[model samples]
Target: MTQKKSPQGGTFKKFIVVMVIILIIALGFTGLNYYLKYFGPNVTGKQEYLYIHTGASFNDVFKTIKDEGIVKDSTTFYWSAQNMNYVNRVKPGRYHLHEGMSNRKLINMLASGTQEPVTLSFHDLRQKEQFAGFVAKKIEPDSASIIHLLDSAAYLQQYGFTPDNVYTMFLPNSYQLYWNTTPEKFFKRMYANYEKFWTPARKAKAAAINLDPIKVSILASLVDAEALHDDEMPTIAGLYLNRLNKGMKLESDPTVIFAENDFTIHRVLTRYLSINSPYNTYLHTGLPPGPIMMPSVNAVNAVLDYQKNDYIYMCAKEDFSGYHNFATNIADHLANAHKYQQALNERNIKR
Candidate 1:
């Protein structure tokens, strides 16, 4: 239908159409971004500190980004992150992050976590003091920083070392943490594992024996020090358990060495027995001040589930294979000890 039209009205109508097209394109981009933030797979990005830490929330993550000056408007960022679909994929612990990453980029990085690395392990630590030293070497961390943080005096002992809480720590399994983990965080992670390991069932078993798990660990450490093989560990543990139940002295040479701080075990004199230290099992009546060394789990488990037998004493014969002779009475033990001493004198070569 032909109709009369003004030139100005015609130009304005064309301009309105162009404005509508531009608005449609802008809305499409916004919707696409929303989809990407929520439903996009394999979200990934690089980060500097490489960790998220414990007790951190989504808001904390958003704040970290804001404080880094990666985003200009925090309100917009917080709202976007809150509305994102993939936000639940964020994990706890350390993560690698990138500088100046957009909200879209950060979400992807968390969802696709190829960034977290395994934290290093502390191996063969004997005492709490050694654990601190171990952290410095294993983590290449500032030793001075963690030294005072993990005092064995606080963590390992209360009444004495024998009554200490060494078993409070759990053995390591597969765990995901940042490589540059701090000493406090490392202790917390380890303590958490420790608590998990001491389940109620295990605690009940320890109570049945009238032995604190930590005390059992103390004995386990002695067995660990005495044994050269894992096979004889249970028998060794059984001997200690039997002795404890009988109200007899342990008289272990390792306890003596623990008191002396000297590692040489080849030679022992009557004077050594007279060494004035509570750790000397020969002089004292019970288990020495906690674990003399960081015993293996096998050693600890062996002590926890020791065989209930009549044997009250154990002494290794000429063989250094860690096997021991078990006896029901002190007379039998003295005889075995005599034989063991003769064998020891015959093969007196120090390595």
Candidate 2:
């Protein structure tokens, strides 16, 4: 014996079931929205880069991201960053952004302080200040700060270098490093590389030639300045070595130009040679006090493996080619110099 339901009660039961279904759908929709907002991709555009400067606040980081239009939704990104505690962990560096990166991914990267390394390379740097300035352009530290460290005598003495010869510590090459490296770290890294470059074989070769590493670098710089072509570096190195062995003045034109502090002088004059600077090889009978320019690795090696020859003098060829004519005697050298001088006169290079 079953009892029949009333119309009003049945309608009430139907209304209750409808309300429950509506609530379930609403809950599911809200959960999906939350998931999409937090875990889904919120960044927009093709690949891009972002630079977060040191000491930048969270607001600055957000503003930079917003201005660059890197995110698809700002509110979602802000919420995610706050929730992940990235707002307090902003790191300074250069970062590469990929297309369609999620906010979570981006925030994690910023929070971790992971940065792409900067490609740092320097060559033919004429002065310490110039090298510092060049490095400053690529890193966080200013040129003055780097120059200050380089000029510190006590600081350099710790590294077996004087303020004058510290320039030799940096080898000319491309290096990968973080953009925020400090001055001290930069010098230490360069010195480490320099040490690695002076292998046992190279040291032994230097010893055989009676030249220390510093002296070899000094002579290498002269060879580097004189050789316009890589193929001729060995011969130039040999000629200078001969001059050093025979107790003759190096009389390098580059040294005279260096002593005069005039790189613009294409032709070294007798007046420039009289400069009293220790760098004037015309007056000094041996290597200059320090390198005139950053010697390339090839130049450094050329001195270690200098060609065996009796030549004691070299002058630029009269044909205006980059090659030089070698001479073993004073008479032949004078003739070569005369021919070069005549060619210079014809070209009216009268500096």
Top lDDT model: 2
lDDT of 2: 0.89
Which stretches in model 2 have alpha-carbon errors above 4 Å? 1-4, 11-15, 45-47
Predicted candidate 2 versus true structure: per-residue lDDT over 226-331, tens digit per residue: 9999889999999898888889999999988888888899898788888999999989888888899889899999999899999988899999889999998989
The root-mean-square deviation over C-alpha atoms between each candidate and the true structure, in angstroms, is 7.7, 2.2
Model 2: weakest 10-residue lDDT segment is 39-48
Candidate 1 lDDT tens digits, 50-76:
345445677677667666654455555
> Taking the candidates one at a time, how many backbone clashes does each contain?
21, 0
**Structure candidate 2, residue pairs in collision:** none
